[model samples]
Target: MSFRPVIISLVVLALAGLALAFAPTGTTARPDQGDARPFQLRDTEGNLVTDTSLRGQVVLLYFGYTFCPDVCPTELGYVARVLRAMGDDVERTTPLFVTVDPERDTPELLKGYAPLFHPRIRALTGTPEELAAVFKTFGVTARKVPGAGSHYLMDHSSSITVLDRQGRVAATIGSTDTIARSVTTLRDILGKP
Candidate 1:
């Protein structure tokens, strides 16, 4: 019998554990404003980009690997749908896909992968150490675990951290949130009163 199913089950269970580590105990339901952590990483084009450079834009940052089985693809697809529905409102936003598995998710690989979700998506990656730094700053942890033979998967925190026009983390929506809720969260932060 193949161990693939068992390994996939373990990966899902492990991901749940990692996700619980960052789960909030607070009752606060809305995205709160706060200073955004700064980190420099290489974008799809190989140019260095910093959190500070994202000021004046609503930045939606998601940390996951390209190989993520479901959450990554589903969330990206949802974000793409939201962006499409937003029409020109997307111009004021900067959506970033930061890879937790930088060892295999190089700039070139991400360049090809990110746009599949949204045309404006900018994929970011860096050296393993650099990726570690951002993960630390953002209070997320992801680790590779043995999967089926000669393969592995990453278990990472599951949430989308959204920054406001000032580049501060103004809100956080669940990775599994409905598209409407996700859009509302973004609009609340990025929209005019």
Candidate 2:
């Protein structure tokens, strides 16, 4: 049998391993935590949403485009479940969906897409430059992969960056994490239980 498939599988595994290695573990906060930089992007309603404006509220930030076929929808569904499980405690939290493909994911599209996952989930977008800075701040990497003519896909890191009431990087929940685990983490951050 040819080793081409084996080699490809090994390379894919290695890349996934590296991504996990560098990703933040959802655990107890360290003394050096709270390193997330400030960001400003426009919401679906054409209002500017900034880190400062969200102070005193726990933020669950996710980066994905509406055009994403599977991953984005799955992750957002997970977020919606977590929000539902939060019960009344959800009031103190904000879930944000920041699009990586601003060219395709316009305000009108986001306005419809975000509410489908959860009414509380606000979709944000900005200029390429603004998005680049936010990506750098969150250590998120998104690249365009050419597909069929005039079509492209984004290969991006998938993780939910949880910010504390003070707008600090409190924890990170991997896309593969269960809804139960996510609810528990958010509860811990919110000091609920």
Candidate 3:
């Protein structure tokens, strides 16, 4: 008749529920296995960028906003390093920076921000409704965190979604993955050494 065991079981169950609630969406699919959800958004030049338009190239897609103080820049820096390390092989790759905060991350601002990391990175944004569809397609979650009046921060997921030549998800690099790891993943997808 010990209630200790029952209390421990309840606590464990609670913890499991919490973990499930906060877990990120999306399944990690192996190379060339899962079909990437299609999307269309506008690039910095007001050009419509779509999944179908990038069929023959490998894509490195990252989601974040220009105003992100640290994490976004760090992740983008890693992406730039990976591109540089690719050498001539970079020509076959397309690096994309998709803004999760379209309200503030206009194409004009993104045009300035993206090239600061690398000349090849194309920044994109779209209408809020359009962005929401793309976000769901990529299993990206973004929320606005209220800060001081008239200013706020966005809380969002950080990860790189790698797509192969066929526009299918080849791999998903975690936020903590190193540049070397990211390069390796890209190479594997690109079938390069």
Candidate 4:
């Protein structure tokens, strides 16, 4: 049993496992092309937003509450950095801050908080029903937990779901740990020749 042969066999097995685990699900075609899922939600101004409105743009959908003490802002800050890296490319992209705490985050509240991160970012909130539908559609979950007074913590999926030009979910950026990965993912998805 030569050590070289054993090592080579192990390496080949590992490579095969990696390939199977990461193989494209074919659920999302290349970012450059594909039919994306249609997404519709209300802007902070209460205007109805349709999926067609996001055409030819890379959209990052972040689900969090404005009252969030840290995670939300940190994630948004990373998004700001990514946008800055993009520079003019930001024109073709948008960061959307969708509120999980609609009770306290109204259209006006969102409007005030979102722009603090970036000029291109837009915040949105809607009725609980509307938010629930959107969350379900995107596979993000949000639940309210009891808290002090009228305040409560919302347990939501802390992942930034990236939507390609066609409004399909291209990838997910999880928590703050994936900021660098997100920047790379965005740059790669933007595909700026």
| Top candidate, metric TM-score | 3
Put down candidate 3 lDDT per residue, 1-193, tens digits, no spaces: 6999999999999999999999766434333456656899999888899999998899988999988989999989888988998888799999999998888888889999999999999999987778898888877878899999899999887888888888888788754787788778888889931
Model 3 worst lDDT run, 10 consecutive residues: 25-34
TM-score of model number 3: 0.85
Q: Which pairs in model 2 have colliding backbones?
A: none
Superposed model 2: Cα runs more than 4 Å off: 1-32
lDDT of 2 by residue, 109-136 (tens): 9999999989999999997888988887
Per-residue lDDT of 1-193 in model 4, one digit per residue for the tens? 6799999999999999999998633212323334566667899777987678877789888899987888899889878887887767788888899898988888888888998989889998777787777877676667788889977887766767788776777777645555567677887877832
- Per-candidate local distance difference test: 0.80, 0.86, 0.86, 0.78
True-structure lDDT of candidate 1: 0.80
Better of 1 and 3 by TM-score: 3
Clashing pairs in 3: none
lDDT of 1 by residue, 1-193 (tens): 5999999999999999989997743323454555567888888777888888888788888888888879999888877887886767799888889998887887778989998888898999887778878877776768789899988998787677888887777777765677788888888888742
Arrange candidates, best lDDT first: 2, 3, 1, 4
- In terms of lDDT, model 3 sits at 0.86
Flag regions of model 4 displaced more than 4 Å.
Answer: 1-35, 174-180
By descending TM-score, how would the candidates be arranged?
A: 3, 2, 1, 4
